[model samples]
Target: MFAVIRTGGKQYVVKPGDRIKVEKLEANVGDTIEISEVLLVNKEGEVKLGNPVVEGAKVVASVVDHAKGPKVIVFKKRAKKGYKRKKGHRQLITTIEIKEIL
Candidate 1:
Protein backbone atom coordinates (compact mmCIF):
# COMPACT_ATOMS: atom_id res chain seq x y z
CA MET A 1 0.00 0.00 0.00
CA PHE A 2 1.01 3.56 -0.62
CA ALA A 3 -0.07 6.84 0.93
CA VAL A 4 0.19 10.56 0.46
CA ILE A 5 0.86 12.42 3.67
CA ARG A 6 1.38 16.01 4.69
CA THR A 7 4.00 17.27 7.10
CA GLY A 8 5.68 20.60 7.68
CA GLY A 9 3.51 22.30 5.05
CA LYS A 10 4.52 19.76 2.42
CA GLN A 11 3.10 16.61 0.94
CA TYR A 12 4.87 13.37 0.09
CA VAL A 13 3.95 10.10 -1.58
CA VAL A 14 5.41 7.18 0.34
CA LYS A 15 5.33 3.44 0.71
CA PRO A 16 6.85 0.89 3.01
CA GLY A 17 10.65 0.74 3.00
CA ASP A 18 10.92 4.05 1.17
CA ARG A 19 13.24 6.64 2.62
CA ILE A 20 12.73 10.36 2.08
CA LYS A 21 13.91 13.67 3.45
CA VAL A 22 11.33 16.06 4.83
CA GLU A 23 11.24 19.31 6.74
CA LYS A 24 12.62 19.07 10.26
CA LEU A 25 10.72 17.17 12.91
CA GLU A 26 11.19 17.37 16.68
CA ALA A 27 11.82 13.70 17.42
CA ASN A 28 15.26 12.17 17.75
CA VAL A 29 16.82 9.61 15.44
CA GLY A 30 15.27 6.13 15.64
CA ASP A 31 12.02 7.58 16.91
CA THR A 32 8.84 6.40 15.26
CA ILE A 33 6.36 9.03 14.13
CA GLU A 34 2.83 8.63 12.92
CA ILE A 35 1.71 10.98 10.20
CA SER A 36 -2.06 11.38 10.29
CA GLU A 37 -2.58 13.85 7.53
CA VAL A 38 -3.23 11.25 4.91
CA LEU A 39 -4.52 12.73 1.70
CA LEU A 40 -4.83 9.60 -0.35
CA VAL A 41 -4.24 5.88 -0.22
CA ASN A 42 -3.87 3.17 -2.83
CA LYS A 43 -4.14 -0.49 -2.02
CA GLU A 44 -3.78 -3.11 -4.75
CA GLY A 45 -5.47 -1.05 -7.45
CA GLU A 46 -8.03 0.38 -5.07
CA VAL A 47 -7.83 4.11 -4.57
CA LYS A 48 -9.25 6.31 -1.82
CA LEU A 49 -9.00 10.05 -1.89
CA GLY A 50 -9.85 12.27 1.02
CA ASN A 51 -11.73 15.50 1.32
CA PRO A 52 -8.77 17.33 2.85
CA VAL A 53 -7.69 14.20 4.64
CA VAL A 54 -8.74 10.61 5.01
CA GLU A 55 -10.36 9.65 8.26
CA GLY A 56 -8.50 7.17 10.45
CA ALA A 57 -5.71 6.86 7.95
CA LYS A 58 -2.12 7.25 8.97
CA VAL A 59 1.44 6.45 7.97
CA VAL A 60 4.07 5.05 10.29
CA ALA A 61 7.66 6.13 9.83
CA SER A 62 10.96 5.96 11.65
CA VAL A 63 13.40 8.82 11.83
CA VAL A 64 16.70 7.76 10.32
CA ASP A 65 18.75 10.90 10.73
CA HIS A 66 18.78 14.67 10.96
CA ALA A 67 20.65 16.77 8.45
CA LYS A 68 20.77 20.02 6.57
CA GLY A 69 19.77 20.54 2.98
CA PRO A 70 22.03 22.04 0.33
CA LYS A 71 22.85 25.68 0.59
CA VAL A 72 20.91 28.13 -1.56
CA ILE A 73 22.55 31.35 -2.61
CA VAL A 74 20.49 34.47 -2.97
CA PHE A 75 21.92 37.51 -4.69
CA LYS A 76 20.44 40.82 -5.66
CA LYS A 77 21.97 43.75 -7.46
CA ARG A 78 20.83 46.97 -9.06
CA ALA A 79 22.42 48.48 -12.12
CA LYS A 80 24.09 51.89 -11.64
CA LYS A 81 23.22 51.65 -7.95
CA GLY A 82 25.41 50.52 -5.07
CA TYR A 83 22.72 48.11 -3.76
CA LYS A 84 23.93 44.54 -3.48
CA ARG A 85 23.16 41.69 -1.18
CA LYS A 86 24.08 38.03 -0.92
CA LYS A 87 22.80 35.38 1.41
CA GLY A 88 23.03 31.64 1.84
CA HIS A 89 20.63 29.27 3.57
CA ARG A 90 20.46 25.62 4.44
CA GLN A 91 17.17 23.96 5.41
CA LEU A 92 16.99 21.70 8.39
CA ILE A 93 15.71 18.30 7.35
CA THR A 94 14.87 14.90 8.71
CA THR A 95 15.39 11.60 6.94
CA ILE A 96 12.75 9.01 7.65
CA GLU A 97 11.92 5.53 6.48
CA ILE A 98 8.29 4.65 5.82
CA LYS A 99 7.28 1.55 7.65
CA GLU A 100 3.57 1.17 6.94
CA ILE A 101 0.34 2.77 5.84
CA LEU A 102 -2.52 2.20 8.20
Candidate 2:
Protein backbone atom coordinates (compact mmCIF):
# COMPACT_ATOMS: atom_id res chain seq x y z
CA MET A 1 0.00 0.00 0.00
CA PHE A 2 0.93 3.60 -0.54
CA ALA A 3 -0.04 6.71 1.32
CA VAL A 4 0.19 10.44 0.79
CA ILE A 5 1.58 12.26 3.83
CA ARG A 6 2.20 15.91 4.54
CA THR A 7 5.25 17.23 6.32
CA GLY A 8 7.25 20.44 6.27
CA GLY A 9 4.58 22.00 4.05
CA LYS A 10 5.19 19.36 1.41
CA GLN A 11 3.42 16.16 0.41
CA TYR A 12 4.96 12.80 -0.31
CA VAL A 13 3.58 9.56 -1.69
CA VAL A 14 5.35 6.61 -0.12
CA LYS A 15 5.10 2.87 0.21
CA PRO A 16 6.56 0.25 2.47
CA GLY A 17 10.33 -0.15 2.10
CA ASP A 18 10.57 3.07 0.13
CA ARG A 19 13.19 5.56 1.12
CA ILE A 20 12.82 9.28 0.41
CA LYS A 21 14.48 12.52 1.39
CA VAL A 22 12.24 15.04 3.06
CA GLU A 23 12.66 18.40 4.75
CA LYS A 24 14.71 18.35 7.94
CA LEU A 25 13.10 16.66 10.87
CA GLU A 26 14.15 16.63 14.51
CA ALA A 27 15.21 13.01 14.62
CA ASN A 28 18.35 10.94 14.40
CA VAL A 29 19.29 7.92 12.35
CA GLY A 30 17.27 4.83 13.26
CA ASP A 31 14.67 6.96 14.94
CA THR A 32 11.11 5.99 14.27
CA ILE A 33 8.70 8.78 13.31
CA GLU A 34 4.97 8.65 12.98
CA ILE A 35 3.39 10.87 10.36
CA SER A 36 -0.29 11.36 10.97
CA GLU A 37 -1.07 13.88 8.29
CA VAL A 38 -2.12 11.31 5.79
CA LEU A 39 -4.07 12.83 2.96
CA LEU A 40 -4.79 9.72 0.97
CA VAL A 41 -4.16 6.01 0.95
CA ASN A 42 -4.52 3.24 -1.62
CA LYS A 43 -4.54 -0.39 -0.71
CA GLU A 44 -4.84 -2.90 -3.52
CA GLY A 45 -6.57 -0.34 -5.74
CA GLU A 46 -8.96 0.65 -2.99
CA VAL A 47 -8.66 4.40 -2.63
CA LYS A 48 -9.46 6.54 0.40
CA LEU A 49 -9.13 10.29 0.73
CA GLY A 50 -9.54 12.67 3.61
CA ASN A 51 -11.01 16.13 3.80
CA PRO A 52 -7.82 17.41 5.36
CA VAL A 53 -6.29 14.34 6.87
CA VAL A 54 -7.41 10.82 7.62
CA GLU A 55 -8.06 10.25 11.27
CA GLY A 56 -6.54 7.16 12.84
CA ALA A 57 -4.20 6.83 9.86
CA LYS A 58 -0.48 7.14 10.11
CA VAL A 59 2.73 6.24 8.33
CA VAL A 60 5.62 4.87 10.30
CA ALA A 61 9.12 5.56 9.12
CA SER A 62 12.65 5.22 10.35
CA VAL A 63 15.26 7.87 9.89
CA VAL A 64 17.93 6.70 7.51
CA ASP A 65 20.24 9.71 7.49
CA HIS A 66 20.59 13.45 7.52
CA ALA A 67 21.67 15.11 4.32
CA LYS A 68 22.07 18.36 2.51
CA GLY A 69 20.78 19.18 -0.94
CA PRO A 70 22.95 20.40 -3.77
CA LYS A 71 24.07 23.97 -3.50
CA VAL A 72 22.07 26.58 -5.41
CA ILE A 73 23.80 29.75 -6.58
CA VAL A 74 22.11 33.13 -6.73
CA PHE A 75 23.68 36.03 -8.54
CA LYS A 76 22.56 39.62 -9.05
CA LYS A 77 24.21 42.38 -11.10
CA ARG A 78 23.48 45.88 -12.28
CA ALA A 79 24.55 46.81 -15.81
CA LYS A 80 27.22 49.55 -15.99
CA LYS A 81 26.96 50.00 -12.23
CA GLY A 82 29.82 47.66 -11.33
CA TYR A 83 27.59 46.08 -8.65
CA LYS A 84 27.35 42.36 -8.26
CA ARG A 85 26.38 39.86 -5.60
CA LYS A 86 26.57 36.14 -5.34
CA LYS A 87 25.25 33.67 -2.83
CA GLY A 88 24.82 29.94 -2.44
CA HIS A 89 22.64 27.78 -0.26
CA ARG A 90 22.02 24.15 0.59
CA GLN A 91 18.85 22.92 2.22
CA LEU A 92 19.00 20.50 5.11
CA ILE A 93 17.09 17.31 4.61
CA THR A 94 16.41 13.98 6.19
CA THR A 95 16.22 10.58 4.55
CA ILE A 96 13.70 8.13 5.89
CA GLU A 97 12.66 4.59 5.13
CA ILE A 98 8.99 3.74 5.18
CA LYS A 99 8.28 0.88 7.52
CA GLU A 100 4.54 0.59 7.78
CA ILE A 101 1.14 2.19 7.16
CA LEU A 102 -1.48 2.03 9.87
Candidate 3:
Protein backbone atom coordinates (compact mmCIF):
# COMPACT_ATOMS: atom_id res chain seq x y z
CA MET A 1 0.00 0.00 0.00
CA PHE A 2 1.00 3.60 -0.51
CA ALA A 3 0.00 6.81 1.23
CA VAL A 4 0.39 10.51 0.66
CA ILE A 5 1.60 12.34 3.74
CA ARG A 6 2.46 15.92 4.48
CA THR A 7 5.56 17.00 6.34
CA GLY A 8 7.76 20.02 6.41
CA GLY A 9 5.33 21.92 4.23
CA LYS A 10 5.68 19.30 1.51
CA GLN A 11 3.80 16.26 0.37
CA TYR A 12 5.33 12.88 -0.28
CA VAL A 13 4.00 9.58 -1.59
CA VAL A 14 5.59 6.76 0.32
CA LYS A 15 5.29 3.02 0.81
CA PRO A 16 6.52 0.56 3.39
CA GLY A 17 10.29 0.29 3.57
CA ASP A 18 10.74 3.51 1.64
CA ARG A 19 13.32 5.97 2.86
CA ILE A 20 12.68 9.66 2.36
CA LYS A 21 14.37 12.86 3.41
CA VAL A 22 12.14 15.55 4.87
CA GLU A 23 12.58 18.84 6.66
CA LYS A 24 14.16 18.63 10.08
CA LEU A 25 12.13 16.94 12.79
CA GLU A 26 12.71 16.76 16.52
CA ALA A 27 13.67 13.11 16.75
CA ASN A 28 16.74 10.98 16.90
CA VAL A 29 17.88 7.98 14.94
CA GLY A 30 15.82 4.85 15.52
CA ASP A 31 12.97 6.87 16.96
CA THR A 32 9.54 6.08 15.62
CA ILE A 33 7.41 8.90 14.30
CA GLU A 34 3.78 8.82 13.31
CA ILE A 35 2.67 10.89 10.36
CA SER A 36 -1.02 11.48 10.86
CA GLU A 37 -1.51 13.98 8.08
CA VAL A 38 -2.51 11.40 5.55
CA LEU A 39 -4.04 12.98 2.51
CA LEU A 40 -4.65 9.82 0.55
CA VAL A 41 -4.16 6.08 0.71
CA ASN A 42 -4.45 3.28 -1.80
CA LYS A 43 -4.69 -0.41 -1.05
CA GLU A 44 -5.96 -3.42 -2.96
CA GLY A 45 -7.28 -1.19 -5.74
CA GLU A 46 -9.31 0.85 -3.29
CA VAL A 47 -8.56 4.42 -2.46
CA LYS A 48 -9.33 6.64 0.52
CA LEU A 49 -9.02 10.37 0.43
CA GLY A 50 -9.61 12.83 3.21
CA ASN A 51 -11.07 16.29 3.06
CA PRO A 52 -8.02 17.46 4.93
CA VAL A 53 -6.66 14.35 6.55
CA VAL A 54 -7.85 10.87 7.16
CA GLU A 55 -8.93 10.26 10.72
CA GLY A 56 -7.23 7.38 12.51
CA ALA A 57 -5.02 6.80 9.49
CA LYS A 58 -1.34 7.17 10.03
CA VAL A 59 2.01 6.42 8.40
CA VAL A 60 4.61 5.12 10.82
CA ALA A 61 8.23 5.78 10.17
CA SER A 62 11.58 5.42 11.87
CA VAL A 63 14.18 8.08 11.94
CA VAL A 64 17.20 6.99 9.94
CA ASP A 65 19.49 9.96 10.30
CA HIS A 66 19.87 13.70 10.38
CA ALA A 67 21.45 15.31 7.40
CA LYS A 68 21.94 18.49 5.47
CA GLY A 69 21.30 19.21 1.83
CA PRO A 70 23.95 20.48 -0.56
CA LYS A 71 25.00 24.05 -0.15
CA VAL A 72 23.43 26.70 -2.37
CA ILE A 73 25.42 29.79 -3.21
CA VAL A 74 23.89 33.20 -3.71
CA PHE A 75 25.89 35.89 -5.38
CA LYS A 76 24.97 39.47 -6.13
CA LYS A 77 27.02 42.16 -7.83
CA ARG A 78 26.63 45.66 -9.15
CA ALA A 79 28.48 46.77 -12.19
CA LYS A 80 30.99 49.66 -12.01
CA LYS A 81 30.06 50.33 -8.40
CA GLY A 82 32.38 47.51 -7.25
CA TYR A 83 29.77 46.06 -4.98
CA LYS A 84 29.54 42.32 -4.52
CA ARG A 85 28.00 39.92 -2.06
CA LYS A 86 28.16 36.18 -1.70
CA LYS A 87 26.33 33.79 0.60
CA GLY A 88 25.77 30.10 0.93
CA HIS A 89 23.24 28.00 2.74
CA ARG A 90 22.40 24.38 3.40
CA GLN A 91 19.06 23.12 4.58
CA LEU A 92 18.77 20.80 7.54
CA ILE A 93 17.11 17.51 6.74
CA THR A 94 16.05 14.27 8.30
CA THR A 95 15.88 10.85 6.73
CA ILE A 96 13.08 8.57 7.75
CA GLU A 97 12.28 5.01 6.83
CA ILE A 98 8.63 4.13 6.39
CA LYS A 99 7.78 1.20 8.58
CA GLU A 100 4.07 0.68 8.20
CA ILE A 101 0.76 2.22 7.17
CA LEU A 102 -2.08 2.07 9.63
Tens digits of per-residue lDDT for model 2, 62-96: 99999999999999999999999999999999999
Tens digits of per-residue lDDT, candidate 3, 1-102, equal 899999999999999999999999999899999999999999878999989998889999999999999999999999999999999999999999999999
RMSD of each: 0.6, 1.0, 1.2
TM-scores, one per candidate? 0.97, 0.94, 0.92
Model 2 clash tally, residue pairs:
0
User: Whose TM-score is greatest here?
Assistant: 1
Cα misplacement distance, residue 14 of candidate 3 (Å): 0.1
Residue ranges of candidate 3 with Cα displaced over 4 Å: none
Worst 10 residues of 3 by lDDT: 42-51
lDDT of 1 by residue, 36-79 (tens): 99999999999999999999999999999999999999999999
Residue 30 of model 3 has an lDDT of 94
In terms of TM-score, how similar is model 1 to the real structure?
0.97
TM-score of candidate 3 on Cα atoms, chains taken together: 0.92
Backbone clashes counted, model 1: 0
